[model samples]
Each structure stands twice: as structure tokens, then as C-alpha cells.
Target chain A: MSERIVVDPITRIEGHLRIEAQMKGNRIEQAYSSGTMVRGIETILKGRDPRDAWAYAQRICGVCTLVHGIASIRAVEDALNYDIPKNAQLIRNLMIGAQYIHDHVMHFYHLHALDWVDVVSALKADPQATAELAQSLSSWPNSSPGYFADTRRRLADFVESGQLGIFANGYWGHPEYKLPPEANLMAVAHYLEALAWQREVVKLHTIFGGKNPHPNFLVGGVASPIDLNSDSAINARRLSQVQDVISRMRQFVDQVYLPDTLAIASFYKEWFKRGEGLGNFLCYGDLPATNMRDRDSFLFPPGVILDRDLSRVHEIDMHDKAQIQEYVAHSWYNYSTGKETGLHPYDGETQLDYTGPEPPFKQLQVEDPYSWIKSPRWRDKAMEVGPLSRVLLLYASGHEPTRELARFALAKLDLPIIALFSTLGRTAARTLESKLLADAMQGWFDDLVSNIKRGDTRTFNEALWDPSTWPETCQGAGFMEAPRGALGHWVVIRNGKIANYQAVVPSTWNAGPRDASGQSGAYEAALQDQHTLVDSSQPLEILRTIHSFDPCIACAVHLADEAGDELIKIQISG
Target chain B: MNALKSIPVLVEAPATRDFCYQNTLPLLHEISHALRRLQQEQLPTTIDLNAIPFGPGDEQRLLEFLGRGEVSAHLEALGNSSVWESGYPGIWFIEHRNESGERVAFQMEITTLPAILATHPDDIAESLSSLQKALENPSLGHRIGD
Candidate 1:
């Protein structure tokens, strides 16, 4: 009954990853997550001015580059104790929100759908019925016969162009594609529509950062303030365009994304059962001004576990570093003594050797150094971080908008809101949050306009807070929400430059290394119980589910490409 | 009726580059030599350095790390204000005055921190002491010095 299902070279994702699932009968018994290749990004930053870390770090992952840019800037800021202005904060929030909407929409339609909905089956869809479905939804835009026809023509043109970046080597006519021909046609048209919309929305980040695909944002504040004529920073028309784009996103998320998720996810109810990894969730508080200082002011409240029918909860003081420790038992490299220690980020070690199992207590003293990423623990537990954690946190904190949005979505789908604990639930929450965030951004924009009109137009502080003047040794960790999930950058600065810079990225929590106890990371645990419904060798479903976690491996990158390098992603749990 | 003029297709110049992220010196050398060969062969791809941030006053941090001294070329001062986190990545950025009325900028970077540490007096002294007994000349660094 035991079988090893390998999903190597996970396609449609940004980077290379392979999932080796040890399945016992239909359920996964043990999951070995392997990522080969060391990009030497830290080496890439070794001598560069620490300020340029953002510009370069963002390039680590294309999809989540914006988050990395912000995270790197935040880390440096933490070292310098630089505080951003209110206008800068608003601009950042809007830009980051734009990325979230864009990412969520792209993930839903482009990446995740291919796993479930068959594309070639779409060719069989009836144009008339597809048109009818479009017309049925009043709020939906461009859902007409002519629109679908144009979509067909455009897809053909692109195919003729031979620029199939997304659709390359696709499993086009999978028998599992469950939609009728007309419905497929409708979805296909929307898919094309989504791509065009995606391009426009990504521009929102460019308006603030100066370029898309990793826009440059200043650490203390933005590079420059928003002014209409100065040709220095982003122009006025661009700002308005950004605001308009945000509005359009709200419309799309509400009328399109949310509805589409429900429609597609409803068909895959079986996924609701399996692929639900470590029910224990951790969401670091986000939106600093909205919930400043008060740790409880999480847009999503702290931590929740759904064992007793989604009833019980607990508070996690993530400050307890002892709870985090990584294991190299199944890893390739050998540690000197196999002793795991709580080393700061700047002093991170990457000793590469495959000496097999490590001895206890000698973890830190291991003669061989392994991995660029250090295992982070939260009360000695592996925590899940992502849309699920964010939404769950929001639900726990009882944010009115998030609460109502969740309720409305569940009601619309006739789903129990508690079902949000499932994968489908997490997906819905993201789409719902997307719609809600779109509306919230409008209000935030208004507040920004008010600030600008009141002669509070200054955005950046070119001043650097002197860390040398302070006590020679003090450590601080920044906990905020990246678009994907919670992101924290811990910095220790001495003299003038940085002495230590460590980060526990959101994906690290979701796709971390095994703990000192050899327990799996969040995604590994999530993949434990799943039926090998199709080809065990190429389980795209597992890839979809795991990638849905969107692990950020760059945070864990070291000189070597061992599990130790990626161990950073797994915020080890108790 | 739609009428359109017939156009003849001609294949000519297309925009592309032989630029690559050469991670090793061998790769860079190989590409350079290949470009030489290609220039002789009149190949299509144009290989040239697009932009290098290394120049005087650029403070190429990489070079600083490698213990290289600072060199100021033609860099516009930030108006005598040193209160910001701005520096040209610790490497010198230089732009020579071209009489043709054009602009040229390039950066020199060589891991500023490591370079500095490698050439530091204390570190050099330690290395010399470690090799003191290996030679009778009594000059640990004299092998490469005056």
C-alpha cells in the first residue's frame, strides 16, 4: 500500500519544486519536500550596500517580488529604526493590496484552475449557452456573445503566434474537466479577460514603486511623494489610474473572482476533505496603523485550531524563539553535533555536507553546516501561513468587514462558514478578502487625499536613525503581513552597518523544514492524507494544493541547496 | 470592401543581446572570446556591456568589501547632506567628460566588505604571523612586497 508519488519540476509555478509523497493506500503517509538548486542570493547581497537589498531581493521570486522588496526594506528600516510617514504608509498599503488582488485573481483563474478544469474540454463548449450564462449575471462585464467570439479569435491568434508561456505542455483535454461546453466557453473567455485585467492591475504597484515586476519602494518611505507635475515621482494621471484600477479590482473580485472560486471549488468538494494541512494556524498581525502596538489588533486575530468542531482557540506569543528548531534527520547534509541553536539571521551558517543523521544535543556543534535557512519555531510548533491564516486571523479578531464577507460568501454558496477551515474555505476567504480589500482601499485612498490636501504632502524621510548612538546591543523583530501571509524581518545592527539580518517569511511557516522532532512542515503535514486518484508519479493536484501555500524559499536560501537552505521556510512548531 | 496594400517582407536587424549573467570569470572570459570570434565571423548577436554601476564616487560596496580604496570621478554631490541612507552602493560610480556631448556611466563592484577585510592591517598581520616560521627571510609579506 505504500508508494512514492513524485511531482517533479512543478510546472505553472514560478520556481522548481518536487513533492515526494509517501502514500499508504489512498492517504499520504509521509511527504518529503525536496527543492534542488542554490541561487546564492545571500552571496548576491554580501558586499552590496544593504539598501540595495530590496532591489535585488525582489528578483528572487517573480510572483512575490513586491513582497520581498517590502520585506527587505523593512528589515533595513528595523536596523535603522526608521519610521515611515502616514502618506507613505497609505501608498504602501494600496500597492501591496493591489498585488494581493492581482495575485489572488491570477492564482485562481490561471494556475489553480488548470489542475481541476480541463482546457481542451473548453473547446467543446456551446457558444450560445456560454453567452447566456454571461448575460445572466447582470453585474458581470462583457459577458456577451460577441465577447466570447472575440475571445476565441484572440486565443487562436496567440496560439498561432506560438507564445504559449502559460499553456505550454498543458494537459489540455483531461477527462476530468467537468464543465459543459457552454460553461467552458464562458470560463475560457473570462480567462482571457482575466489576463488583460491582470496586466492593468499590476500597474498599480508600478505607480508607487516605479516599475512592475518588483517595483522599487524606499524603506523609510516611498522614493518620492505623489505630485502631479514634477516628473520626479509617479504622475497624477498615474495615481488616478491606480485608484481606478483598485476600483476595477473591487468590481472584478466581487462579481468575478469570488463567484468563479465558488463555482469551481464547489465541483471539487473532495479536496474539502483531504489536503488540509496542520489545522493549527498562525497569522502575524498586519496593517500597522489600523492595529498599531496592540498585538491583539491583528486584521486576523492570533492563532486558532479547529479540532473540536472549530470551537477551541489559543494565543501564541510568537516571541518565544525556543519553540522553533529544524531537523536534518532525513536531509542530505550532516551537522557537527546535530544540535539546533537559535542563531540570528546575519550570523546564518551554510555548511554543506551530506553526512546523514545527526546526533542529539550536538545539533549546533555539527561539524558540517547545512542549509541557508534556519528553522524557526513558534512554541515548538509548525504553523500554516497564507490566505487561510490571514482569513482565520480576521475571523478570530471579528473584523466586521471580513466577518460579513465570509458570512455572505458562505450564505451565497449554501456552505457552512466553519467549512472555511477546509482548502475551499481558505480559497473563498482570499477571494472574499480581495473584494473587501478593494472597497477598503477606496476609503484608504480618500484618507490619503485628505492628508495631501491638508498640506501633509511629504512622503519620504531621508533621515537615518543612528543605531550606533543607542545601546551597543539591542534586538527587535518586525511582524507584518506580506501579500501572501505574515512576514517578519529581525535585524541586529552594531557600530554602523548590520550585524545580523534574519527573516521568517510566510512561506517558511507553511513549507518549513522538519522540526528537531522530525515532524513535517505545514505543507508536508497537509499532504499526508490524500488519495492518489490519478497518476501517482505526476500528481498535479498535490502540486496545486502545495503551491497554493506559495512557499517563499528565497528566505531560506544559503550557499548550499540542501533542505537546510529551505528549512528557513518552515517556522518549526512545538 | 476592405482594400490593403501588399507589403513585402524583409528580414533585417532584430533587437537582441548576448548579455548574460556570468556567474564565473571563466564564463565571462568564454563569452568575451566568443564575441571576438563572432566579430570575426560577423555573427548577428551584439555582445556589449549594457551598464556597470561601478565608477568613481559610486562607493561600489562590493569593491569596498574587497578592500578597494574609494575613487571619486564625476559624481554630483547631494548638496553636502550626509544625513540620508543614500550612497552609490559603496562602489565608485564614474562618468568621464566626453567632448561629443554624451553621457556614460559605469560602476565597479568587488564585494566591498570582503575586499576591505582581506586587506585590513590586523588580518594581514595575523596571516603574516601564521606564516612567520615558514620562511627565513623574516618578511612574511615580502614575497609580494618591496
Candidate 2:
């Protein structure tokens, strides 16, 4: 008999998620990934000014605010054939780069690290031994015995006070924890340091966007004013501040974040064998481009890798109705044409149909409409998208930095290239890309400053700013590589207003429910592949694989109430 | 306490704005002090923006006065939460809510990073055995710790 183990609202990720896995003994036979919320942001964008779409669309998720805004503007620009100034592209690149670094660092230390590090064990750690271990790993300057002692003291206080603060409600002292006391202590110290580090790094976003979350964005260009002398504008002082922030980011990635990832990941070398899903990777290339149409100059090439083959990269066409379509057969949505047919974003519909077992049920009615997220398929395939996909895409494209970094990481761990397909590999990929972007961002910053110095201070292009200048009806696809994975926004305009807008965010591709053909998504497929539970009640194995993808369900199904609350009322009755 | 009482609250002359907070002097002083500590020590601090029992529009007024800083993050790991640094270096605003989007925890964290952003050890302990068992399986078809 197969026992179904459900882990609802999987902790330490963005938004509410429920994972139901069927276990025949210790091995998982099948899994279901469900986003327990409805995303109606696309419906909200209907009949609104296409120019102002970024502001509302940016609210899809608080975690990835700028990516949507960028994608939204790019969609409008693609439709109207508007080209922004070169400086604007450079600034946008810098902002996106900062997001990747900031987000990846936070994910590694704060979100994913706890899956591996044993905090309760750290209580037994000797501060001096931890300092010695830190010194042996890397040249990070914060490895003093005093520093470790301070961190340990703080932990002791939290433990003794019976108030763990953020550390509360965790499954402590489980039989799964493997790291020794010293290693745990070292990771705990860095976890504290990363918090301080991230606070300073986000200043770059505020400097450019005026605010960090949901920053003001204009359709043509950024909303920031360029004035070299003004205290309020993008002046000399602010430029230097950006440079300082970049320096700080570089130091932390090299000194703390990268070293900590490698050190902790070294303990769980077995993870490199599991969590490999779909083996089909897709990347919508971004960065290192002056013009949006110039695909040849992309740093991360846009292509699809099928069956883990690197020989031929398949071309991507976001406009093809038959190429990329969303299936609703297994989701809590109804398609106008039928549940079996896939609808392209241009013809996408947002009809809510709840067919799952009502809340508090023992199990989801997995046979039909199990999730609120629509199944997004690329060429009718369930493709995995995220850092792992992007890194593989880069490695397949023969990008030098990615090739060197991937090879070096594999060699460092004494593992072969095939290991990159597993859970630890997925995580290592994020850290590798973070290092790559950390170096690439400086080049973009340099280009921006030099352009400003050369008197090309223009950022926005006003040629097609007005809706009257647009064609009577136009539709276009705006695609970019968000920190999570491939993000695309499709927009249709009629008489200068948005006829329809559909955003296929990263999480939808990774965490969506089953498709029309009963094919599992990246999350479901990966979880069921080789996952086993020592104790089914403690389904930490499921979280390990799912959190590796960094599931952000809020981005998948976007919406909240008047008080900006996302409240789901669950009824429990037999 | 008396020193806090000495600070004068700044009230804008009545105008047509939609919302106004009567007395924000205490909050502003705390923010200012937090900012000073951040600059001086390179520390991160957080303030609970959603938990206060402020009058009708005081939260909005306080946030606006803090102004937007360079970086903001939406953390969805545990719940729906948002963290942003004030224009002043170290002061941060953190707000967390439960699944239904009801505010559960809010604080003004005056540190280099907010406490909510770090992963706790207990979360890892739950999985160690599963990870170890997965490795112990000979059918996994991969070498471990070679």
C-alpha cells in the first residue's frame, strides 16, 4: 500500500505550497505540486494603459519586484518597436545583476542553508575550532575566534532564553543532521554576517529606482533623473555609492557566500545524485546586449536543451501559439476551448474553476484540477527552469565563464559533469551564477558611468511614448531571465490599451501542477524521481528537493485583497 | 524617557492631503538613532512597521517619512514579508504575515540584516536522516564522498 504524505505550505519559500507524495515503502512513487492561491494579476491588467502596466504588474510578488516591471516595459517596447537609449540598457543590466546577487545570497544562507546545517549541533561547537575550520576553507577575514565566540554567545542566549526568534518552530535534532558542531557553528556565523551584508547591497536598487520594492518604472526608460551636480539626481556622489555597493557585493560573494556554499555542500556530496527532473532546460537569454533585437550579443544565450543533450540548442519562439502554450487539464482553471488544448498567452484565459477536494481534506483529488497554477509547457514538455537550467544552457552554449566555473566546481568536488543534474548541483549552480554575475555587473556599471561621462546621458526614448502612435492592434512577447528562471510577459494592445496580458513567470514553469498529457512539472518530477524518507512524517527529503528550485508561488498565482492580504479560508469538517 | 519627551513633534500645516499622523516625533527619533548606529557600526537594524497601534494613517506617514532606501526585499520563505532599509544606513522595516495575509509579526530590526532572513539550525535537523538514508541506498547509482 502506498501512503500519501502531505507537506502543506512548505516553509522557507515564497508563498503557500502543498506537496503530496505517495510512498511505497521509503521511496516516493509519485508527487503532486499545488499552488494553493489564485493568480488574477493578468485579469487585472486587462483594458489598462499598456504604459502603466509595469506599476501594477510589478506587484505580482514582493520577492521579484523589478523583474516583472522590466518584463512589462519590454513587452510594450517590443509591441511598439521602441528602442531605449544605450545608457538605459546598461543601467537596467546593473539593476538586474544586483537582484541576482542579492537574491541568490539570501537564498543560500537564509532559505536553503538550514536544509543542510544543524543549528542545535552548533551549540556544542567550540568557537576556536570553528575559526580554525573557517581559516582552512577560505581567506575570508571574519574567522577570528572572537567573532565565532560572539556568534556562539548570541546563539546560546537565544537557546537559553527559550526564545529562538526566527529559529523557532523548526524540526531540531532530527536524525538527518550530519554536519559536526564546528561546521554548523561556521555556517551559523556566516548566516548572521549575510544578513548584515544584504542590507547594504540593496542600497543600489534604492539609488537607481528611488525605492527598493516596486520602484517607479517608465515604459520608455528608468524614472531616475540624470543630473551630475544635483543632490537629488543621479549625481557624482550616488555613482560612487553604487561603486562602493558593488565592491561590497564582490567581497562578500568571494569571501563569505561562495566559500560557505562550497563548505556546507561538501558535507552532503550524496545529494548530487538525486532531484534531477525532466532533464529539459530552457533559458530566455539576458544581459550583455545593447539592443533587445540583437540576440547574437547575449551573454546568456536563449535556447532549449532536450534530454540533457548539448549538441543542438533548439530555437525558441515566444510568438508561436503552438510553440509555448498553457494547459489547464490538471489545474484549477478552465480554458475556453477545452481542458485538453493548450492556449498561447496571446489567447490565454483566466477562468477560475475549483474542482479539488475542499480544504482540510486528507488528500488532493489529483485526478483533476488539483492546483490553482496553470500548467505551462514549452513545446509540450515539462522543462525545468532556474539557476540549474541557466547554468546548463550556458555550459551548452560554451560560454567561457560558465564553462570554467562549472568545470572548476565539479573538479573541486571531484565529481563528474553528470552530477550537475542533482539537488546539490541545482544549489551549486545558483552559487556559480552568482559569482559570474558579480563579476559581470561591474562591467555594466563601468559602461554606464563612461556613457554618462561621454555626454550620452539619455535613458528614455520618447519616440513612441504615446499610445496614439501605436498600430490599431499589436501583440508582442517580452522575455528575460529572472533570478529564478525564464520569465516572459505577453501583451496584446488595442487602441493603446491592454487588450490582454499574460505573464509566464519562472515558478509556474517549475512548480505548476500536471499538464494535459498527465506529465509532471519540474517540482513534481524531481521530487518523485529518487527521493526517500527515513520517516514519512518528517518529509524533509521533499523540502530539500523542492526548496532547491526556490519555489515562489506568489509570483505564480498573483493577487491579494483590499488590505493587501492574501487570505485563504480553509473549512475543516468530516 | 525624559529625553524622548524633550523632542518636538513636527506637524505639517493642515492641507488637503488624504492622511496625516499627529505625533511621529518618538518614532522618528528611534529611526534617527537606529540610522546613527548603522552608520557608526556597519550594523543592520529592523523596525516592525505593521504591528504598531498607531492612529489611522500613522504607519503610512512614518514609512513615507523614513523614505525609500536603495534596496527592498520581499521574503516569502516563512510567510508574506517585506524588508526595506530606510534612507539612513542600518534601519530596516520588516513585516510578516500568515498564509491568509493577516499580519502575524512586525518589527523594526536595527541590524545589518533582519533576523527573519537567516535560516535556523532546527530546520536542517529534520532532514539529516533522510539525506543520510538516501545516501545509504546502494541503488542510488552514484558515488558519495569519494
Interface RMSD of each: 22.0, 17.8
DockQ of candidate 2 relative to the true structure: 0.02
Q: For residues A1-574, what per-residue lDDT tens digits would candidate 1 score against the true structure?
A: 6766666556655555556676776566777565443565544454345566677667766787687777777666654556778888778778777888898888777766677666556655556677777666546967777777766666667777887776776766554456666666667776767887887788777777767887887767888566644434544445567677876788888788777777777666666666676777766666554423455533445564444123556655444544433344434434444545433333343445444235332122122332333444566666777787777767766678888887877776677765776666666667877886787677677767666656577788767633344544434455666656777655454444444445567765665556566667776777774645465544655765775665556543333222233222223222
lDDT (CA) per prediction = 0.59, 0.81
How close to the true structure is residue A418 of candidate 2, measured as C-alpha lDDT?
A: 94
Candidate with the greatest lDDT versus the true structure: 2
Taking chain B only, the TM-score of every model is 0.18, 0.58
lDDT of 1 at A227: 61
The TM-score leader among the candidates is 2
**What digit string (tens of lDDT, one per residue) describes model 2 on residues B17-120?**
33334446667777677777777986655555554558634666667766778878898754588888877656677777764455777787778777667656
Candidate 1 lDDT over residue span B1-146, tens digit each: 00001112243342532122222234345445544554576432222222433222123222232342444333233212111111432322233223222233222222222221235687678667656754655554344332
Distance from true position, residue A456, model 2, in Å? 0.8
What would you estimate as the lDDT of candidate 1? 0.59
**Per-residue error (Å), model 1, residue B123:** 80
